[model samples]
Every structure is written in structure tokens, then in C-alpha cells.
Target: MRLLQQPWPLKLIWLVLLGEACAALLNREWIVGAVALTTFGLTLLPLYVGRVSGVHIPSGFLVAIAVFLMATLFLGEIRNFYERFWWWDIVLHIGSAVAFGLAGVVLMLILVRGERLTAAPITVAFFAFCFAVTVGVFWEIIEFTADQTLGTNTQRSGLMDTMWDLIVDCLGALVGAAAGWIYLQGEQGWVLTGTLREFVRRNGRLFSPR
Candidate 1:
């Protein structure tokens, strides 16, 4: 049957699972369990939005953001504020941003193909960096607030760690975007067929609407 030919394997799987993982990790030390509740809310955000919007975001993108948010949150959960950050902090660091390129090239590939890299390289690159930097700042803000009000020492380990985390994340985003763009222009094409498009075109009979 044509229904068996739908998508959502690699991309969606990575997104959902990664997001869930980050959420779980951040909540690892929740005392009153409120943080866990908050993380659960975050991890399921896409599902909530998807339910309301009647549309699905690229799983990979969701995963990327989730993981990023989780990274920021995890960084926040340090003990002191002036200690030299350690190296083995992240047990499962995927280096996702710089690796996946803002979900740009690979994401686009998951949708379309044959698109050449643009001449204004800075265009995509800038946005990609902006996304990371912005998210980094946002994470910092969340940490500060958590520390100021809730006294989540674990969340705001300190200034040094927070700063370092932002820098690392920004680098990952910028670099990843470039890599994705480069790969796009190479041989492997973006994924389009057997995706949501085909799902809609075929009258929503693709994946059994789990």
C-alpha cells in the first residue's frame, strides 16, 4: 500500500528522542519535582503546539531546539558561581548545532533537493549564528532568573560556566549551518518525497495517524 511509504524516521526520531533526553537530564536533580514537571512541559511542547496548529514541525528542528534548551538548562544546574568549568559536564553531547547546521541544509534536504548553495554565504550563516546566540542568551536569562528567585544553584552553576556554554553553543550553531549548507550543495539531496507533502497529497492516509 502507498501508506507504507511515509516518512518521520531519522529526522523526527532524532528530534523527539533528543528533546526527551535533554528534558530528562535537566530534571535529574529536581528536589520538589517541580523542575521535572517544567521539563516535561517543555519536552511535550511540540505535541501541544502540533495539536493546536494541526501541523507538524520538522522533528529534527524540534529536537535541535529541545537539545539546545536542555543544554542551557543543564549548564545552569551547576553548584558555584566562580569555579572553573569542567570538561566532562555533558555525558552525551551531540554537538548538534554546528553538527546539524540549524537544521538548515539537512532539514531542507529532508524536504527538497538540487538547491545550490547561495552566493551571499553570510545570509544563512548570520541567521544560523543569530539563532544560536539568541538561544544562548535566552538560556543565560533563564539561569539567572532561576538562581535569583528559586535559588536553583544547580541551574546557575556560575558566570564562567554560563559564558563558556554560550560560546560553545554559538560556535556549534554557526559551524553546523555552514556544514549543512556545504553538504546540501554536494551529492546527497534534501528529503522531499515520502514526507509530509506526500502525506497531504495522498489525503492523510500515510502513517495511520497514531
Candidate 2:
């Protein structure tokens, strides 16, 4: 069936989360069960968004997001990977910044109604970089709030950790912006370009001139 042929990576992750939730519930670990169940629900977000907004995200993009969620929510937080691995936090921050930067480009394209030729590449890239940095700042704010209010040590080294995260966020955003700029200049062979092109192709009505 067509449904069976959909991306399996996300499905596998959902199944894992479901099983984890069930096991936690059986063991009477309410908090763990709730977290696992919540994560499983979150993995369905792409499908929900598509149904409501009619914006068909590529399966690959959905898989990427699902993997990120699994890493952060299921593995990083639940499995204590953040405490076990020193570099995990850094890698996640950079990866999230880059992902957000690319998302900014896509949002801008939607705002411009896909009139790529009308927008300056530099302007689009700048917006992408700013969007990514802004999201990173917000994330740091959340971490700080959690550490203060919830008594959680998410900030770890406090100011030092926050500063390093912001630094890497900017670096990642810069890379994303450069990639977007290159793609907008009509270059090919880049992964981001292919994804963007696929988005535009699938949502032709969104990009078509009014």
C-alpha cells in the first residue's frame, strides 16, 4: 500500500517511543511514561501540519525532524545522554541552528510567494542567519528559565555554556546562509538545494505567481 511505503525511519522511532511508554507505564514510572507518550505524539506533528495547512513537507524533511526529536527528547533527556556525553550538547545546538536557518529560507520563500528572482540572494541569506540566531537565543532563554525555575542544571557551566552555544549557533547559521545563497544563485549538487527545490516543486501552487 502507498501508506506502507512512506518513510520508515520516523515510523520506527514512533514504534520505539510507543514501546518505551508502554514499558514505563507497566513499571508505574508515570513521569517517564508521560514523557515517552508525549514524544510519540510530537512525532506526528508533520502529518498534522500537512493535513491542516496543506503544505506537504517532504518525507526526508519529516525524517530529519523526527530524528532530531528522538535525539533530544528520547535519548538526550530521557536517556541522560546530555550528562554522559560532553559533546552531545554542542553538536545538537549547531545542528538545530543549521536546521532553523534553512527553515527560515523556506519561510521567506513562502512570504515572497516563491518569487525567488525578485528577492536578492543576500537579503534572503541575511534573514535566514538572523532567524537562526534568534531561535538559538530563545532556546538559551528557555534553558536559563528551566535552570532557575525548575532547579534543573540545563545550563551546566552557566554563562560559559550559554556563550559557547550562541557562538556555535552563529557559526552554523553562517554555513546555512552560505548554502542558501549559493542555491539561490542557481548552483546545484548541494543537499539543501535539492530539498528546497523539491519543496517548491511539490507546492507549485504556493510558488506560482498570483
Q: Best candidate per TM-score, number?
A: 2
Write out the backbone clash pairs for model 2. none
TM-score of each: 0.48, 0.92
Name the lDDT of candidate 1. 0.48
lDDT tens digits, residues 1-210, model 2?
134556888779878999999999999999889989888788787788886888888887888888888888888998998899988988888888888888888877778874545667898899999999999999999999999999999899999999999999998898778777887899999987788778878988886666
- List ranges where model 2 is wrong by over 4 Å: 1-5, 114-117
Q: Global lDDT of each model? A: 0.48, 0.85
Give the per-residue lDDT digits (tens) of candidate 1, residues 103-176. 44333332333245433435555555565566667767887888889966644358776767776776677665
TM-score of 2: 0.92
Candidate 1 residue runs with Cα over 4 Å from true position:
1-41, 59-119, 154-157, 183-210
Per-residue error for 35 in candidate 1, Å, reads: 5.3
